[model samples]
Target: MNFTFEVLPEERIECLRESCNKLMAFQKSVASIRPELFDTMNFETRLLPSMEKAIHNYTVVVKNNDEIIGYVYSNISPKDTYSNEFATFFDVTSVNKPYVGCLSQFYIKEGFRKYRIGSRLFSMSLDWLKEFDEIEDIFIFVSNGNSNALEFYKRKGFNISHDILDGFITVLRN
Candidate 1:
């Protein structure tokens, strides 16, 4: 299968709406710890606000011809940004740097999951995040029950830091 990867400009982030919504639904389906929490999560609630708050953003989309098959969203954000009204993502003070990098969101359509597309997307996102010298800590948050994603990040060099939201989310750190 011939697939193309493109870095989406912030102005065109809307191009990811459908894929983003589906990713949320997929997570909800796999969530056992608090699936209802995903009811408030979607392109608008989750990804949009994340993009707005991030200091720097990187989004890459994979296409099979014209259909978007996958996407990965990463960002550099203030370490304090992780501690907010929502459950504090991690101990902000633990990171000496003012900013941190996050592999914020990732998804590959069911049919495309076995194609190594995810590996490529992960690598691209991490490479972009690594470009920032100020970023010392990199994190990936996996919703509960998404063992495959948890293991993928682990194998790629992230370690399980802790769970938040009463075990609804697993925080992985590098």
Candidate 2:
């Protein structure tokens, strides 16, 4: 199927509610270790807070005709943001910049997989993240059991940085 990609502005993020929740459910369905962790994660708890804390945000939605089948959300935020109570996503001292970029959340519906729709979204998000001069590092976190996503980010040049939350998350960095 033909697909169109659009940049979803911060104010229009409401349209992502359904897709974002679907992404959390999809991650929970695939996670083998502590999949229950996703139970508390959804549009409100996850995406909304991230958007609020971020210094800059970029979201790309892929559409099939008028229906949005996939989206990627990214942001630039203080490096300290990763060191909160939940988990330390990376080594703080390792990054010299005060802020960092993250390809925060990405998802595509099942039927739309393998169409390179994800590749385009990935590129769009990565390019947006790289646009910020203060961003010293970029990260992508893949939940345990999502090898496809892990490999996808790896192919795109992000190395496996480390695991956090008892191996539930595999952090990738560029």
Candidate 3:
């Protein structure tokens, strides 16, 4: 199988929409197994919008044969008042800094797992974040139950900061 890893392009708006729907589906599937940990409704209404915003120049996707199989959405900017959900996942106030970047949403289709697609997408986003000198560190939240995700981030040098809303937010300093 051939795969391409790159920043999500503006011309591929449909890919963005499809990725969001796939992510929501993935979350809902997880919710079926651990309903208390995953909220499909909140993901659709709240997290989806944030991921959409992050798509602007900050998102990376892995495609196989021109089909998007995974993505990592991220953003960097001066800290400001954010949604309660955002605060719930990250220690926003503790940042106490001018600017920060966030790895907001990351997903790879079930069949595509263990293929290093996610790792390539994440590394691409980290490389993009490095271009911004103002960003102090990058933040990512992983479901406490998702041991695979937690281990992946840990392997990539992310440290657990604290628990939030049934998940542990991790940080990777730039």
Candidate 4:
């Protein structure tokens, strides 16, 4: 259960093979809870595409005994997609600005969920945003039905900035 966190460079993870396994793990995890979202996501989905594009800009990895246990892919988005949908239901009232670090993908293996790997990965994202020197804000999304994830973000001090009904997008301001 013990592990360490490492920030993987962009070049080290540009290829599909390097992070594909974890992507598959992430896909399975999302499918287990929200198949709809999972179905909409593929290798060509927004998360990976955006992550791949931002590889040179931002990326973070969680390592357990030198193995990648989880990762959070992020970049900027002018319009918060999720907000246009469920934000009203969650009573999200935050305003979206340009170039916000959009949290594209996040996942932790089943066995490693409780080991602070997720937190470490998230912290790495926050640290990157803080020092990037070009970003405006950081944003992320969570499925509405995924109570565990919602609660986890809440516990981590991430408030519901807005919700996207079409998919449920939650943003944490840092």
Residue-wise C-alpha lDDT for candidate 2, range 1-174, written one tens digit per residue: 779999998999999999999999999999999998999999999999999999999999999999989999999999999999899899999999999999999999999998989999999988888788998799889999999999888888889989998999999998
In candidate 4, what residue range of length 10 has the lowest lDDT sum?
84-93
For each candidate, the alpha-carbon lDDT, in order, equals: 0.95, 0.93, 0.66, 0.58
Better of 3 and 4 by TM-score: 3
Candidate with maximal lDDT: 1
Counting only residues 3 or more apart in sequence or on different chains, how many pairs clash (N, Cα, C under 3 Å) in candidate 1? 0
What lDDT tens digits, residue by residue, belong to model 3 across residues 93-172?
67766677777778897789978787788888888887877767677766444667878888899887766544433333
Give candidate 4's TM-score: 0.68
- For model 1, residues 1-174, the per-residue Cα lDDT tens digits are 889999999999998999999999999999999899999899999999999999999999999999999999999999988998989999988999999999999999998899999999999999999899999999999999899999999999899999999999999999
Ranked candidates (lDDT, high to low): 1, 2, 3, 4
Pairs in steric clash, model 2 = none
TM-score ranking, best first: 1, 2, 3, 4
Error of 4 at 135 (Å): 3.6
Q: For model 4, how does the per-residue alpha-carbon lDDT over 109-148 read when each residue is reduced to its tens digit? A: 6687876777777777777666655565565566545667
TM, every model = 0.99, 0.98, 0.77, 0.68
Score residue 86 of candidate 4 by CA lDDT: 21
As for model 2, its CA RMSD to the true structure in angstroms is 0.8
